[model samples]
Target: MIIKRVIRSQNRVIVEGKNLVKKHIKQGPGHEGGIFTVEAPFHASIVQVLDPVTGKPCKIGVKYLEDGTKVRVSRGIGASGSIIPRPEILKMRATPRPTVAGPKDTPNESCAGEDTRS
Candidate 1:
């Protein structure tokens, strides 16, 4: 594996790999000598170099099969899943709503913004 790009921020580092995207440039109809290229970047966090046997995080472990292919396994360490509250979960759903409403449409508009209690 080749290390392409790396960015360090505080206690974390972000890395980009070349395998993320394949660049292709093709000449258009009656096009000049301008080269066209497509570039795509993948998140480094999506990939990990782990052991072949276990599907966990690992510092170093690799094995090649008889078919000349390499296998990897996680190094036995990974981030834990997150836990969210029920109210917070509902906030992510979609709900229908009116397009627009005028001041006269709702008689309580003015009162709603004001504090009724002295």
Candidate 2:
């Protein structure tokens, strides 16, 4: 399972486990508490960030720019071999912005609570 979030202060990382364990808690006066199914934390050493280019878990490598700015790169064999910032990804979407979701403004009911939604 991959790590979903990292809690550095507590030195723990929340990873997607095989199953969600339900934990019960007593509600305090100021807390809206209940039985919650939350992602359990694992050892930080076991967690690894995936390479955006190859989509594989690998050790992160840092390379400095000419102006002394540090950048992270992937060591994946199938990745683009370059000392760079972010990988190049082209998302060729089928639907453009205009055809996609947006607030449909009706001409007549431009005032008050006449919503122009389906």
Candidate 3:
């Protein structure tokens, strides 16, 4: 199953076509009440990462390369022990840090222990 999203704080993941649940929405202002089918979050430990080379689910282990770069590899039963490349989405930042301070941003002087309320 493909992982749709990860809830790191809760140690849960929403896997595609897994752990489906029915959500009951209450009627509220400008909202309609209905029963909706949605993907529920499950413990991350319950799922296994598939080995890219073997195309089978396998336990993952951390391996360090010669250059000291750490990577995840398949390590359990019938494992091919191939390195697993990180998904591109995981490398992307959900919200990039602002390069320039906005109007609501605190001035650098105050942040650096300088009193701005003189």
Global lDDT scores for all candidate models = 0.46, 0.67, 0.91
Candidate order by TM-score, highest to lowest? Answer: 3, 2, 1
TM-score of every candidate: 0.23, 0.44, 0.63
Candidate 2 C-alpha lDDT tens digits along 13-104:
77777346788978889887789887777668876657666666766678787999778866666655445345343245445667444567
TM-score of structure candidate 3? 0.63
Minimum summed lDDT over a 10-residue window in model 2 is located at 81-90
Expressed as tens digits, the lDDT of each residue in 24-92 for candidate 1 is: 556678865444443344555655553335434445345566898654323335522222113343356
- Which one is best on TM-score? 3
Q: How far out, in Å, is residue 25 in model 2?
A: 7.9
Compare the candidates by lDDT and give the number of the best one.
3
Worst 10 contiguous positions by lDDT, candidate 3: 109-118
- Report the CA-based lDDT of candidate 2 relative to the real structure: 0.67
Best-to-worst ranking by lDDT: 3, 2, 1
